[model samples]
Target: MPSAHRERRRVTWWVALPAALALMAVVLGLLLLVAWLRLLPDALDPFGTRTEDRTGPALLESIQDMSRYEAASGNFQVVVDLDKDAKFLPDAVRGSRTLFVGAGTVGAHVDLGGLGEDAVTVTEDRKSATVTLPRARLGRAALDADRSYAVAKERGLLDRLGDVFSDNPNDEREVHRLAVRHIEEAARESDLTDRAERNTRTMLENLIRSLGYERITVRFAPPSG
Candidate 1:
């Protein structure tokens, strides 16, 4: 009986050490887990958030605020019809598009501030003067939102579906851009620059005549290349 009791005691003593060591391991593991959790970032998931910087919008705003002095303005209207088809598929239209009727104004200008000391010539008596002005050039084109509008629009199934997952330019800004482009082209082709030069000549002639000068010569400088 005493031998049986001693054998049981020995078995219990052996089991007790392993159980205590396992409990210590478990506690240490819990502490390590708490320390690891503290090292994680505050914003883990990027869902439903914008990660891009805001430099683009700010740049567009700066562009819109700039202006230049314009001498003559030409008003024009054009129909902007565009169609985009899938690049790999048949020629049938199947993509996003920007279509509109656009009305805008283009201006021509001459930088009078660039005139040199020889641009104006005066007689010794200050009775009459001859002035030469700089050549006229095209200015920034502007779109009138009140007169510009979308005529029609058709989007492909794929493009419409992709709108939900991506960022794309809408019709308004692109339409205005198209209008400005065409207006600038037309202004370059038209006689707006000549008209600007003529207008400047007439204005200077009148101003000199009003200053008691009987003869005033106002000429535009030859166009620069």
Candidate 2:
């Protein structure tokens, strides 16, 4: 009888210990969850749930404008008229420049009207030459405003945390910002002559396609007369 009682007590303790541990773990988890909720009350509303509908119209307009000018969805064009007396040659091309715009996911293209078909003719003085570019071969750029906003939002939160926690935001935001900054910097770093060239090319290609221009020609003139 005594041995049986001891065995039963041992078994009860083994079961009770696990149950108690489990209960403690569950309680801790709940507390952590509550704490997290307190920190980011809007976390459950991830898709801008609290955003006001009043801004809908404005947002749409902004989106439209961005899509047209900064985004890659609309047409972009620019024209650079050179002096008639200017002589542009192959060597003069070194100092030529172009402009670019960021439109949308597809990016910005170059302006075709700025470069005429006869612009590429090399002159005897090697002073200047016209270069015509087709719109189809232009490059496009991608932009992610939402990603950038998320990063800025996350960074704002970290700043409020008083330097105790690491200020790491979502990876998407970082990537988006890096890409935007890189393109902007590139535009600034490139020579003035070529600065607008990439953008112009992209724009011309998009415009030609949309306008049904099977063959589009642009002309460039010498800057110095």
The lDDT values for all models are: 0.77, 0.44
Segments of candidate 2 deviating more than 4 angstroms = 1-52, 59-108, 120-131, 134-142, 146-158, 161-179, 183-225
Cα error, residue 25 of model 1, in Å, equals 62
Candidate 1 runs further than 4 Å off:
1-69, 90-93, 170-172
lDDT tens per residue, model 2, 1-225: 999999999999998999999999998787677665665366642322455566544343343222122213332221222121124433233222222222223333433445445645445654433346533222434554432232122222323363356544443444444555555454444443343454555665566546444444444333433
Write model 1 residue lDDT over 1-225, tens digit each, in one string.
999999999999998999999999997776566556654343642222346776755344344433333678899888887767777865333575667888888888777777789988999898889998778888778888899888776777777677779777655677677778888888899999999888877877888899998889988778777
In terms of lDDT, the poorest run of 10 residues in model 2 is 76-85
CA RMSD, predictions in order: 12.5, 19.3
Count of residue pairs whose backbone atoms collide, per candidate:
0, 40
